[model samples]
Target: MAERDTTGAEGAGTEAPPDRKRMRSAARLGAVQALYQMEMTGATLKGAEVEFESRWLGAEIEGEQYHAADVKFFRRLLRAAVDRQAEIDQLTDAALVERWPLGRIDPTLRALFRAAGAELLALPTPPKVAINEFVEVAKAFFDAGKEARFVNGVLDHVARAAKPAAFPA
Candidate 1:
């Protein structure tokens, strides 16, 4: 995987444990994968939760190490994203080109928007922080590709709408 935690931007308060950061990062990635899996496989939210929660999350696999994810956070992001996917998609849809609606976007990008939207819309963290984190997640999957820039722009636009109070005059 990609080294995603060294962007030099910290969250709302003091730094979390090194382990905590790793786990949250991992959970973000896993949440994207779970959401993608759900869309592609037609799996229910509960089914995706069970599959990811049981077999992966913290498990080391294919000789790679996985930090133990923040299970509660993972569950919350997954569940909340599923519950408000329509809203998330609507918000993301507003940010995309009229000809390239959310439905026309890549499945992975769709999942990224939904997963990041869940947090950006509801989580207590700063919007910039959420944007940065998701940008990193995008980088992890896209490897500095064009998708990463698209993710940044669309998400930043969504954040301005989702949490206008978080922005300044």
Candidate 2:
């Protein structure tokens, strides 16, 4: 349950980007933040999903298209992650060193890892693609080199441990 202030005025709208890739990137980042909020507050997945949609997708962000497809995709992804969090956490814990249990990691990083890991394990996409997308999301919110490297490394480790068959050759 992240606090919602809605204090700032909405920016003027710009031309929508024709590229779906950019839209997907924005959706993924939205999903990550929603997952992080749910993790921090112990909110139900549905509650978090609605909050994210109302705040990010519902808000009139300049130059962005909050397509229904993107909202649905993000909601599905976040719900899946929350529903299967225990299994995902177990996989993540096994991939990490004993001292670095997921609970001990920064909450934001832990949530990001769980969300990415859940997608990698449960989604139909190739594991490498999921990892790459999540790494890009990490880079946007964190230091590009260090955070992306960390996300990539941990995800690689988790993929190897939990879904070796899905790992790229």
Quantify all predictions' global Cα lDDT against the true fold. 0.84, 0.71
Per-model TM values vs. the true structure: 0.89, 0.77
- What is candidate 2's lDDT per residue for 1-169, written digit by digit as tens? 9975221211223232455445555667777888888767887787887787777763666866554326655765687787788988988888778888888987777888877877766665556767887898888777659878878888888878776875558
Number of the top lDDT candidate: 1
Which residue pairs overlap in candidate 2's backbone?
none
Model 2 residue runs over 4 Å out of place are: 1-18, 58-69
Give me candidate 2's TM-score against the actual structure. Answer: 0.77
Q: What is the C-alpha RMSD of each candidate to the true structure, in Å?
A: 6.5, 10.2
Native-referenced Cα lDDT, model 2? 0.71
Give per-residue CA lDDT, model 1, range 1-169, as digits (tens): 8766443324677676787777778788889999999999999999999999998888889998777888877887888799888888889999999999998988998999999999887566678777877888998888657888899899999999899987886
Clash counts for the predictions, in order: 0, 0
Residue 151, candidate 1: C-alpha displacement in angstroms: 0.7
- For candidate 1, the TM-score is 0.89
